[model samples]
Target: METTRYSVPFSPLQERIAREAPQLSAALNHLLQAMGASDFEKYINSLSALKKVDDHLLLITKKEMYRSVLTGRFLPVIKECFAVKFVRIVSQ
Candidate 1:
């Protein structure tokens, strides 16, 4: 993969969103400690107990340490979603 450097200062949200995986993994580890042991049940309960985890882990994160690791290269995923939406419309 080709790496391009961004010259602008990154905002907290931007950085956090960027480094979601590791920050989330870290967050999950912390959450796991609260849940005690790991399993699907713990996962589900954590989701329910920590609403932000879903959105933050999957979306939000003011923590920027994980930013460099994430690539917001989900354009293809967005394109696929748009295509699927179009198909659904045509079928309807």
Candidate 2:
């Protein structure tokens, strides 16, 4: 079997995201629900979840499975909840 590993380089931004991970996840869930995207709640829960960085919302995930699944499909909805310039999906 072959295994693919994912890693996130350490940085101040990464640390900030780590600290606010839970709160950010909750806020995102609430926002998704408020926008009548309740159906996506379950899906979002499965992924690593999101956090707001300087001018972007970073989607952190460990598994390659989700990295491929997330893409930028939710960028618009995410922007509605967060006023970031972009949404980036990165592996941790």
> Which one wins on TM-score?
2
Please name the candidate that would achieve the greatest lDDT relative to the true structure.
2
lDDT by candidate, in order shown: 0.30, 0.59
Q: After superposition, how far is residue 59 of candidate 1 from its true place, in Å?
A: 10
- lDDT string for model 2 (25-47, tens) is 55565556754554354345445
Q: What's each prediction's TM-score?
A: 0.24, 0.49
Checking candidate 1 for backbone clashes, the offending pairs are 19-66, 19-67
In model 2, which runs have C-alpha deviations exceeding 4 angstroms? 1-27, 34-39
